[model samples]
Target: MSIWWSLHLRREAASVPLARRLLLGTMESAGVDPDISYDLSVALSEACANAVEHGGDGALDGAAEAYRVTAYLDGETCRIEVADSGPGFGAAGGDAGRLSAEAENGRGLYLIQELADHVHFGTEPGLGGAVVSFDKILKWRKGASPLLAV
Candidate 1:
């Protein structure tokens, strides 16, 4: 079975946990394993935090204060994408894998890469924003089939 959802949220710190909770609820209800669910929730938080912090035009007003998040669950795999209207990673030119440990910031992408089974960066659909997408292969806790919930 396949399930998906998308959320267009304000670029606020509070919105981060809202997205995480929703993802956790969805996965738990579908019988996803606890460990996989925890990892994905943490990874999703990092991705959402990145979008909230960097995905907007440097302006503090208007439409620049929003980001989009999408998630898909298909059988044993779950994919997630977070996109923002700010300048993309390409413009910043920092490698996600090479961040310094002592830096006060810049670890979101690295965390996502570490948690997700696959990761990709690109432009948001039709918005020219930075998009960080990742996916993980899920393991059911007791041979449960998520398709049944579909």
Candidate 2:
């Protein structure tokens, strides 16, 4: 079985923290622990920030076109989808490598890849938008992949 929650908000700096908090709350309610909760929060925040940054100009005209987030929970697997009403970008593959020690930026996808068990993009052609999704496995039981055997 799966459960989902969604919300849309202005694509602004202030909305980033709000999005993080709301996602954290939902995950916590689903029994995600504190440490894991922090990971989820950070990953979700970075994804949303990326969306807004690349979410194209005039995407948020005083809360007009907004960014949407959808989270789906199924047992130990929780998938978070952050969608933006703007043009999409090409995949970086799982090649979301970490930034160099001296680099000041470019670690968003890298962090998300490290924290989430799976990360993928859902691009809707013609519609001209995309959904960035990452999945986490909480309290994994036997037979689960060791990478997500938290």
Candidate 3:
């Protein structure tokens, strides 16, 4: 069974926890291993926080007021994508360099990279925004597989 959901949320602080909670609840109800769920939730939170803080590129057209979060559970993997209407990663969009320990920002992307099995950071194609997408091989609680008949 493949389960997927998408949310378009305002670029506000409260939206961060709201997205995290929905993902957590969905995973828990689906019987995903708690550890895996927790990891994904944390990564999701970081991604959402990044969007809330920087998703808007400071345009007067009001185009960057919201962001999107999409999650997909298929077979043995869970994939999540967070997209925002902003200036995007620009030239520093990849793992081109390491951040200093004293740096105040830009840690969320690193955290997401470390927590996810595979991560992809890029712009939203020609849409001119940042898109953070990652995937994790899911572990199901014994008798509670994501593939189980619902």
- List per-candidate RMSD values in Å: 2.5, 5.7, 2.3
Q: Which candidate is the best by lDDT?
A: 3
Error of 2 at 106 (Å): 3.3
Order the candidates by TM-score, highest first — what do you get?
3, 1, 2
Q: How many pairs collide in each candidate, listed in order?
A: 1, 0, 0
Summarize candidate 2's per-residue lDDT along 20-90 as a digit string, tens digits: 89877766555666677788789999888977776654633543257788877776788888877666654
The sequence of per-residue lDDT tens digits that candidate 3 reaches over residues 23-126 is 99888887899999999999999999988988997777877999999999887889999999988877677441464434566787778878899988888987
Candidate 2: C-alpha RMSD to true structure equals: 5.7
Model 3: which residue pairs collide?
Answer: none
**TM-score winner, 1 or 3:** 3
Off by over 4 Å in 2: 57-64, 91-105, 140-150
Give the whole-model CA lDDT for all candidates, comma-separated: 0.84, 0.70, 0.86
Per-residue lDDT of candidate 1, residues 53-109 (tens digit)? 887887756667999899999877999999888877664454654655455676777
Between 2 and 3, whose TM-score is larger?
3
Superposed by TM-score, candidate 3 places the C-alpha of residue 116 at a distance from the truth, in angstroms, of 0.5
